[model samples]
Target: MITAFLHGFLLALGLILPLGVQNVFIFNQGATQPRLIRAVPAVLTATLCDMLLILLAVLGVSLIVLQVVWLKTLLFGAGLVFLLYMGWSIWRSPAGVSQAERPEPFSPRKQIAFAASVSLLNPHAIMDTIGVIGTSSLQYDSPDKWVFTASCILVSFIWFVGLAVCGRLIGRFDGSGRWLLWINRLSAVIIWGVAAYMGWQLLASA
Candidate 1:
């Protein structure tokens, strides 16, 4: 049981540890506008989306996704475009913008919606949860599968909460705007890198 739990945790970490679009956005929200109560909703929504994907994966639905040729290409193309757009947006935005200038404040519901969209729109998240985590869970028994699922859920909750809190802490700093700009730029670079890699993978497979 303990080993199974550990395995699940590792699997969850493998999927979530990368600085993907969702993570980058969460960190930005946390670090820049800590006072925005909406950030918590966003984080929780993202976590829930991840849990849902894991559920689908555990149910063996991921296999169907892998079997489809056009679906894979479509997903890859969408992800590439999304990541590139995000990167370009971040690159174009000025980091020194005040919190007041950050645009309309998100309501709690809207924050969750935004988070969900940010998480679920990325096809790679689906692949990671359904393909990678789902396949990994098969090594364990039913009980172990539960343990693994639980571990993944725990990781999601902990990671998002920690990220939100850290962002708030950073926002409290006086010169945080500069830091936010740097972070945004860093996120752009990471997103572009991921986009390039995904494009390459798709090309190789083709």
Candidate 2:
């Protein structure tokens, strides 16, 4: 049981530790929002999406879903387009604007929507969940399997909350928002890089 728990915890952490679009958006929200509570929608939505994906992956459902060629192509195409748009949006968002001129932060509804998009639309993230976590879960059985699944889910929840909290702390110190502007630009670049890679993969598969 201990081994299973550790395996799941480490595997999930390893997968999530990378600076992916989901993490970037969550951290951005935590920093830009007026208060941490305002970022809860994004945090909760992302965590729930991860939980759903992890559960589906461990249960073998996502593997079956990815087996469909056309469906997989469609996922890749949609992911590419959405990521490109999201990158542009983040890049253009008013981060370093003066306080009087700065636009309002993302509303709760917008936060949830964007969180879901980044979480669910990215085929690369889905494939990673299925390929890594799904295959890893096969090594366990019954109660151990459930234990492993729980451990993975727990890691995601804690990691996202911690990420947001850390972002909030950094935002508190950066009163002028100059740091936020750079962070947004960096996040956009990273997101576009991922999108380009996915597009290349989609073309290669054609």
Give the root-mean-square deviation of each candidate in angstroms: 2.9, 1.3
What is candidate 2's local distance difference test score? 0.88
Q: After superposing candidate 2, which stretches have Cα over 4 Å from the reference?
A: none
- CA lDDT scores, all candidates in order: 0.76, 0.88
lDDT tens digits, residue span 1-206, model 2: 99999999999999999989999999988877778888899999999999999999998998898899999999889889999998898889876556543324788998898899899988878989999999999999999999999999899889888888987887777777887788788889999999999999999999
Measure candidate 2: CA RMSD.
1.3
Alpha-carbon runs more than 4 Å astray in model 1? 34-36, 97-114, 121-124
Candidate achieving the largest lDDT: 2
Model 2's TM-score against the true structure: 0.95
